[model samples]
Target: MDLDKVSFNGQIVDMTEDEDTMAVEAHVRALVLLEDALKKKEWLLLDREIEYEKSQELDPNCPFLHQQLVLNLFHKLQEVQLLKNGDSAGKTYVYPNPDSVNIFLGQSFWESKEYLEQWSRPGTLILAASQILGYRNVAGTLTASDIYAAFETWMNHNGIYKNGIYTCCGEALRDSVCKESSMSHSLLPYMNEFDETDLKKATLDILWDCQKKCLLVEHIEKPQALLAIPEFPIITTSLVQELIEKLKQVKFKCDTRADKIAYTDPRTRNIIYVGNHFWKQKDYLSCGSRLGTIILYVAQLLEHPHLFDGATKDITSETTVEHQGSNSPRSFQEPLNESIHNHDRDPPLPLKNSTPSNIGDALFNKSKSETYGKCKHTADTICAAFEKWMSHKGSYENESYTCCMETARHSVCNKSVMRSCLSELESRLKDFV
Candidate 1:
């Protein structure tokens, strides 16, 4: 539990080095398995045919296969999300962004990188499926109408079978799915009338696909080359130059040029995204996309019918109990102990203890302190710990800075100018204790 020893456990494997060739082999195997499934149109089947018995064991929990699935899905969904909005209807996914500026930039990025490269390999893209939809290669000339008609028929099929699901209130669900769905082939055959939750989940996946695809097109175009594209001709060189500098300041090297196009979510949708760096949104956290994408991802993932039913809720509650019951950090963190013990008896709450004292204590309760001394003590401790956390985050970021090499300007800007910034920051934190 040592905080200072947070470096990755064990020796770091140099991926490019011959010694760590296993990692390379693993990735290749995964991509191969994924391609076999997609080329055969076995997406949902792959979901059902999983390693784990439980459904929750998807996404990150299914680490070995998740990224490849997501990537492949994104590649399949490209035709829908990347094209201009039109009679395309359900044939394409629209960027969730309502803001015109965001849409334009997103479209520019999609056209930048040849998104086709993502799926041109022996297997699916390494890390992008499931979230994207609408990959129909019907006669190499599938129109929007064909896709929508197929989707509508699928909806009716599911509605006929699931008709009993409607109570007086929930019964109205059939009409809902039909309303939101534009037009497309129903990927899920038994889904004639999706409830509100179902539609939301589908929407989330579509939006996630949009963001991933947006990066593909832009990053494909070299920054200089993009300026010459018919649409982005007058893009100020200064802005592009500054953007490049910012990326270097953080040591972010885009393996693919399309990854350079920035994604900005102005929080129009209260969704947030969660995934590995490879599957995550570009510059995910601090980037304009922020919590919205993560929320979107989780919320959508949670939209299945079982998720809303009592069965899933009870399971989640049980899991929470097993993972974070009473024997937790509250046993050691005094303030947290009192807070938990005194909390109103409503839903059972678990405690998290697998954290260092600096962060773990911050979760304690200060609201119930009866005296000024107790209140001040708890307040001070929380404030001090927060300051320490901030310093650590700042130092890590400072150490991350890199310098950009300008071929014309022969000068170093911020190349690993490691001062004692981290050490100095740590020293300041120690005094707080």
Candidate 2:
């Protein structure tokens, strides 16, 4: 099996193989299917037992194929592992990974002339990347409550006053809805005690309705003209500008404006009064209020349950296998592969055949042996390779230098920028070799 041919053998399994060759054939088929699945970004539904039936038919002595897939296969096969999930509750989620970041960066380059345009729309991957990278001042995992608070903050800062009481189009609609929410036209129905499940269901229903109504008010009417409204004064502050810049940097372009007193709901022309005082309170909550939606959007996009938490664990090959006769049948969790886990922060591990022999090997191959090489000249070569990859990806400026590094560090060795960098070095070494 030539590693080079592994690149293009999409349909390598032959159906005519005899029983003696069936086990090997089955293994090949599984690998091929798995690779194909990854290319399509379909992570789930790969563990179907039907795929293994052919091998069992051919060789009764064949070992039972593992149902679980490990992240190690990513390193061995040289593919980025973008997401991970299991059959366990709260465990099955797609979290951000380095490979996914690269794909997004690459996409930004492909989709827009200005990479920053990745932030032009709501819920872009760039927003998620910023949160994951801790570029924004946001300090914790995002949550639904955070999103609700953000909406409220936006409202409080922008609300118009009617008889000294702050109100906006959203509030008007919300008040009406809340009043009607009671089945008997009173709050009595909602005020009643209920079991945990029933209360949770009721709460979710109300929240969902509130969100729709908020959207409705926003759509109902254009905000009254700022010039015509005597109650609102034009705000002037550098902090507001700074806030906008921060939000833009993190890709959370909230609808906060200083020049405008109120904004019109694009759909219904309902005037929504949102003041510009949210920036007055200088705290993390202010930042969270501004960017909280983006953070939650990121979490939802990745299907991560812990909006404000870090990843559960690194998925590696050593810990991919499950023990037989275990009490846990619905899901499997292998022991952590200490070697791989510990070495994650280190440079890529050396392959048995690719150890560098000297400075020449280090220079030409850019193998792991050269990772410890303490010379500026070797460092120059690696930097040059990195620049080339960035150029190929249309990143001509150093603005994305940290982003690239973060993506590389998060990826498995084979699927990482280290591999790309090494491959770049090997190509350069071809003439020298």
Q: What TM-score does candidate 2 get on C-alpha atoms?
A: 0.14
Candidate lDDT scores, in order, read 0.23, 0.23
In the range 310-333, model 1's lDDT, one tens digit per residue, is 111111121211100011111110
**lDDT, residue 83, candidate 2:** 23
Tens digits of per-residue lDDT for model 2, 1-433: 5321232233222222332243233224323433432332221112333443443332222222222331223232233212211112211111123222221111221222211111211112222222222221222322212211211121111334365343432233211111111111110111122422332233233223223222111110212221222221111122123223332322111124222211112111111122243223212111112112222222222221221121111112212011001111111111111111121111111212111234342322223223322321222222222222211222224432233332221111122343444344335445443
lDDT of 1 at 404: 31
RMSD of 2: 32.2
Error of 1 at 243 (Å): 48
What local lDDT does model 1 show for residue 195? 30
TM-scores of all models? 0.15, 0.14
- The C-alpha stretches of model 1 lying farther than 4 A from their native spots are 1-52, 55-65, 77-81, 86-433
